[model samples]
Target: MPEETFVIAGASLAGAKAAETLREEGFAGRVLLVGDEIERPYERPPLSKGFLLDKEARDKAHVHEADWYDKHNVELRTGTSVASIDRAAHQVTLSTREPISYDRLLLATGASPRRLEVPGSKLQGIHYLRTMADSAALKQALAHGGRRVVVAGAGWIGLETAAAARSYGNEVTVIDPEPTPLHAAMGPELGGVFADLHREHGVILRLDDGVAGFWGAGQVSAVVTSGGAEVPADVVIVGIGVRPNTRLAEEAGLDVSDGVLVDQSLRTSDPDIFAAGDVANAYNPLLGRRIRVEHWANALNGGPAAARAMLGQDVVYDRIPYFFSDQYDLGMEMSGVAAPGEYDEVVYRGDRESREFIAFWLSGGRVVAGMNVNVWDVTGDVQALIRSDRPVDPARLADPKTPLAELA
Candidate 1:
């Protein structure tokens, strides 16, 4: 029998893990992991938190040791991108114009940071955090601090980077059009908590304002807001959001929506193709709807599920969405979906004023999502509550004496 080949594009956390899973599953066929960046696959969470803060070393962010891929007999192609996918030929053309044929293909192309289109965006001082290189550069820029840093967007990335900047003694100003920080993700109620957190830390908040343009001579000097105010900035970090890389799947004639559309098993519209991680808009049975999760947990687990599906296993990628963030002295873990309008009421457990609490988002009296801030050992309980899809008495959920295990 001819040796089967499996090709994984992106070499991201998801793609690299898929390769490892294939070898672990005893697939003796050829495995190729291709990526555009020169560095090997690494975890992204540290880029904004520990790595950016210089609390963690550069090598700590890597998914595996440099020699792991070679020892596992996996073909690692860094600094190489998939230029196009030929579905009929079952092959992908690389940026080097080399063609690699595969029996099964996994597209974990991941995402890129969104760039500002306003004037002076191309200035030298403007930065975006997505890759290891970006983090390293930002760290170097902020390490000596004392610079006027302006962060556009109060989303996760924006706020996290803002925290890092302020920690370095830089005068940080966070500007967002939303009424509060994390308004879209955590809703107005909980978003107010973060707004207060940053405010107490001396970070200026310019809420309900949008960046009209940037003004500077070769480097950004000030951000002009739509509200007709100019805020001086020696350094600018744009963290509006990210966009998934779905070109390869779309060009291959595979289904593509907000991302590559996949089934519960992570299989794409094409039977021979699969997708996971940030680029996959997969149907999650637990959520009863398709969700394209860009969080680290999804990529960490989704890759293995896709690999098993390729191995002819009955796989259902139905894990609840999870993500964590560390800003200032606050550490938080959030499970399930809490997007705006998805939940009716936000219930708090523990002390919100002390910044140590667990907040649950409820929909129709059932726990839809839960976030534990500066709290430990309750992630499982929080997840169980969301998974049980059972209604809980709001009073019991809020009572400090009532255990979360019982409420679920």
Candidate 2:
């Protein structure tokens, strides 16, 4: 008797990782990976970074090159969408009416970029960086020198694209309602450092402002701020954030709160079904709350966790939840979670002035979360220990003379 088929919905990072993991764990099953995208599994982080820098790397975006899936005996289906699921019948209805039965299912549908709802948002030159098509369009709009680009958000995607635009010698302006860029993620002190950096790069920073919409007849040639300031723009990009692509799970009557809610084992309310990646609002043992991490690391780690759980290995899915972003030669790394200034003050390792620093959030005189700029490798042990709330010497944390790993 053959092993039961494992059907996966979505074929991007999380889905592809799950299929690979299943094979690696010696699961002799029929793996059916369904995805709506025609392209193979590719990295999204590179789409905003290296892919933007080097045009040739676009083809290299696929995580698994050509015959890797075949060698693994994984049936990868592209350009196909899963329309519905019959949980009782253990069958999935694809758009093509091809019903496939599965012994297990992994929901890694991820999230979609939220669009700007305005008059001229549908116009040309207004793009959102979510998929290859969006990136390709934005790349074309930003190709020429001296193009007036307006980015309508201070979030990761907007800032990243703004940095890329500035690198390519484009006249860039970033508008956001936040007082400083990354304030939500990095807090005030670090946000100010980021703000200063962007201003230093000659990026026109419009703080505490938002675009009412776009202008021009066919293309978004201008951005009208909330205060009625019309900033001229050759191209407009919106990167407010993404909403979880949880409609399929919700329609299938699966429990969903913000995202498809899953236990620590990455199993959904329905035991046969599992959810991972940006689509899974999982219970965080460290934070003691249900949180959905949108980082690439989550997609990678969570996929394997779900697969392990499905295979009856039963491993606890308590990943460190690390993420990194590089822009304008500055690298930012984060580990663990912060609980609303549970830290009295951020302890520093290096000078923040030079932008080569590690700041740790403290609560009850113990480190909770750590952020390092251009010093990610050193953050490993600190993250592992701090994420577990292991006691550390405050003196060692503040002392540049002391090695952080020593305290860990």
Candidate 3:
């Protein structure tokens, strides 16, 4: 059995965490961590905010120090991609034409940034915030400050980048097809709250708008909107969304839908193979539905869960989905799963206008999801309420005096 080797494709947050967990769980197996990025596995959350704003925060993005991987006996292979997965052979072929066999394999291939197919997208000075190199390039561009920055897509990354750009004193204009930024995720009401926050910080909002094409001589000089209006720009950032990297799994003939379909234990259709992180559309027992979350929290928690399952430990990843975002002076933490239009009513506590409040999405008097804006020490309570599945009184939920713990 070659002492049971565990091969992990993609040196992502999940993959790295799995490697760590394999050893922590008393699995004395050979671990091969492969990745396409040359850098060691690092936390991506800081790339858009801390690393971009402060020079000191650059190294803070690393998940672990350089020696830590070696100390843990993990063979870190960067700048290498997985060419294919051989399901029957229980092996994976690397881009370098090397074959690695595994008793258990993890596919934490994650996702790639959706590229803009519009004309002028190939032009220089246009960027997408995904990798360390991308962030470094954008940071250099924003360092001079006073550049005309047009951020297309009002999603979380777009909004965070716009906020960072504005902080650098760049003339920033954010565009999105929705009526308000984050309308789909936060709903129009709560989304409007963010819109106001950006406007208050001197950010120009071009809502219900999208980019038509780019217009520039060589470098990106302007963004042409669908309305035929040209917005001047020295730098343009596109943050539409990401698509899971499921080519290997699909080619391997594993079950694939929106992402790699996995059971509660994060096991793929093939017993020996597993998937986690942003690429796994895992079944959340708590929600009683299959959902894929592309957030820091999932990648952080899912990795260990998948590892434990691979080790034949009885585990179900039932952690309430959670994610937090920081933009300008506004900071928010959210837990539970509530898609757009899924909740019947939004019960608010504190002031929404002032941006210090907690908004709960209740379905039939039961809290499905909750978000705290500029509010701290309530995420645990909010998650508890959601997991308890108990109906909460609307009046008490909306009342700031009613402690979230009491509701839980």
Candidate 4:
């Protein structure tokens, strides 16, 4: 077995960032980065946002280009997957049926889009946005616009795709069984605002509903609702959520909960193996709990931390939860962890109707979490207050007149 060689599975955000950090930290060990996608590490956030609108937007996510990867001495193996991991042998089996030795392993296999398993769900034009190919397919359908598009899910991906479809002048409709959209991520009170935003933009909105199945001979022609309502469509997009890709880990007998269970150090059940990104069920210090965060920030931040730990450097992933979404002309930035109905009240710092706002989840004058829209600059302050757990006047927080820095 080759000693001091580092191997990482899944070369998306987490895997690539981990490799970059490992080399930058002066670790001269041999590095191997494996990815299922046949492309170098590129940003995913733009796939659903900018790339849908501009073709050249692909350059936005080129993390380390081919030249850069070569200069960094990072061995990037794309279009390959870890079929199984042999912890005892310190080897990982590749999809090509090759076993490679590793002193340390980081499983960063991010996630795949959740699919509707119902009949006709396999029909053509029924798509899921998770990869560059997925985006390209949808983007081609968006060209010249005017196609009737039905989106079956009001999650971040679905909504953002709907926005992109609308921007291209496509007739887009969003359907979800939730009473309000994004209720799980953003609560009902805030999720309702999102429902309004879609409606105001002329996208047909369906709440408290779901798809029955697809209609057509080959390609999707229309969407049938759970309650027997029929909506005509030329394309269907489903973005319910993502499932952590852990089949290889599970088959290898690694401990798996909702995700790969990892300690504060990002190590898995087997000490030689580690996991991060959407695949890592990591311990959250601020929340004092084990949580799986499905965001670019967590994947980017936690990946390097896991790499440092593998390289014998003590590191802890303790950055506040950070994520954002762009839809319509509005941009949202939010941080912290506050559960629903746990807070006694919410404090608003900006106007709601103007499409700019920052609301805090407050309990007994202590800020626990926050929701911000078009106020990206203040997410840091909101994060500080939520983590500080210090007291503040509710009236001051609610009052837009008060200076935000005063609360900190």
Q: For each candidate, what TM-score against the reference? A: 0.99, 0.96, 0.98, 0.96
TM-score for candidate 3, please give it. Answer: 0.98
Off by over 4 Å in 2: 339-343, 391-393
What is the RMSD, in Å, between candidate 2 and the native fold over all Cα? 1.5
Error of 1 at 369 (Å): 0.5
Compose the digit string of candidate 2's lDDT tens values, residues 336-387.
Answer: 7653455666788888889998888877777878888887576677676586
Error (Å) of candidate 2 at residue 159 is 0.9
lDDT of 3 by residue, 93-166 (tens): 99999998889999999998999899999999999989989999999998788999999998899999999999
Residue 317 in candidate 4, Cα distance off native in Å: 1.1
Greater-TM-score candidate between 3 and 4: 3
Q: What tens-digit string does per-residue lDDT give for candidate 1 at 1-408?
A: 999999999998999999999999999999999999999999999999999998999899899999999999999999999899999999999999999998999999998988889977888889999999999999988999899999999999999999999999999999999998988787889998899999999999999999989999998899999899999999999999999999888888899999999999999999989999999999999999999999999999999999999999999999999989999999999999898989999999989999999999999999999999999989999999999999999999999999888977
The prediction achieving the highest TM-score against the true structure is 1
Clashes of each: 0, 0, 0, 1
Give Cα distance to truth, residue 196, candidate 1, Å.
1.0
> In candidate 3, which residue pairs get closer than 3 Å at backbone N, Cα or C atoms, i.e. clash?
none
TM-score, predicted candidate 1 vs. hidden true structure:
0.99
